[model samples]
Target: MGKVTTGASMSIDGYIAGPEESGFDLLFQWYGNGDVELPTGHPDMTFKTTKASAEYWRSLIENTGALVVGRHLYDFTKAWGGRHPMDVTTVVLTHNPPADRPLADENFVFVTDGIEAAVAKAKEIAGDKNVGLNGGQIARQALDAGLVDEIGVDLVPVLLGAGTPFFPSLGVKPVQLEGPISLIEGKAVTHLTYRVKK
Candidate 1:
């Protein structure tokens, strides 16, 4: 089995998305922004070193075998046009599955049970590859449940005064994190990786 990882890009103030109902365009502007090249031979490298930050992001998506996302996120992105950007199997957590019963294909699966079931299914589908937990709420649940092995955050310089936080409180005990396995400083955002201390 492989590790369960979660990642997101948040503002300097730690907001993942803008105020309630506000879109995430500004928070995710780095996606469409120009490329960011990093220096060679960084000591704290985790994954394969890349010349450009965009390439690093692409590599992450490519490496992930399966993904778990919340219902809100799934609906917000319009199911990524019925196909995920990474083109990998994705499991969506929701209390209400579609009326069509199993509305999934080789690309997506909707889990109505809970986050644990979703993660289990994702791990099964992922096999030896990594299972990516996307978005804030779902990531929080995974962390609270001790299902995530690593956390990576792309810290953007901008600060959305009022917005959704990247790591919301789960009302559970604090979770400790270890060494930033990697730190890629980019023109738009800085990527930092931390292993969840088990």
Candidate 2:
């Protein structure tokens, strides 16, 4: 059994994306700032990051077997040009599966039922590896549903004044979280992880 994690890169102001999705260049600077080359499923999207970030990114990719993302992100990336950057299976949690998609494949799976089902299917696919949840909407719903075991963040230095938050408003406050379990400092970014208190 693997853990379910909410992993994202957020600004100092705690936003995953800036207002109108304007500050991506600032938030994703670390992905291109270092000498280490990290390849992705996309032939054109390799990451150049510092040794620390490179190590962290590698570990992330190694442990993450699948992802649960919302429909918004699925459509936003145009289905990541047919596969996600991590090169792992991605489970999309949506209201409706895309009309043209096969709904199940080596690269993608569409779960239209709900977040719980999405997580379960992701976990099944993940096997012994971790399941990563993407986007604020998906993360929030999983957090509220107690499906998230860990929270991972690559904290960037910039502050996106206003934008989509990493975690949207929940039904309750101060949901207890245990130790930051791990923290690694990378160039222009700080990788942090906290375990959710059961």
The TM-score obtained by model 2 is 0.97
Question: Scored by Cα lDDT, where does model 1 land?
Answer: 0.79
Q: After superposition, how far is residue 106 of candidate 1 from its true place, in Å?
A: 0.9
> Residue 8, candidate 2: how far off, in angstroms?
0.7
Stretch of 10 with least lDDT, candidate 2: 170-179
TM-score of each: 0.87, 0.97
lDDT of 2 by residue, 1-198 (tens): 999999888998999999997888988899999999999988878999999999999999999989999989989889999889999999988888888989899989999889999999999999999999985889899988989999998899997889999889986567888878999999999999999988
Q: What lDDT is reached at residue 14 by model 2? A: 92
lDDT of the structure predicted as candidate 2: 0.91
> For candidate 1, lDDT tens digit of each residue in 91-198?
999998767546677868999888899999999999988999985899989988889899888888887887787778875568888979988886577899899898
Candidate 1 backbone overlaps, count: 0
Best by lDDT: 2
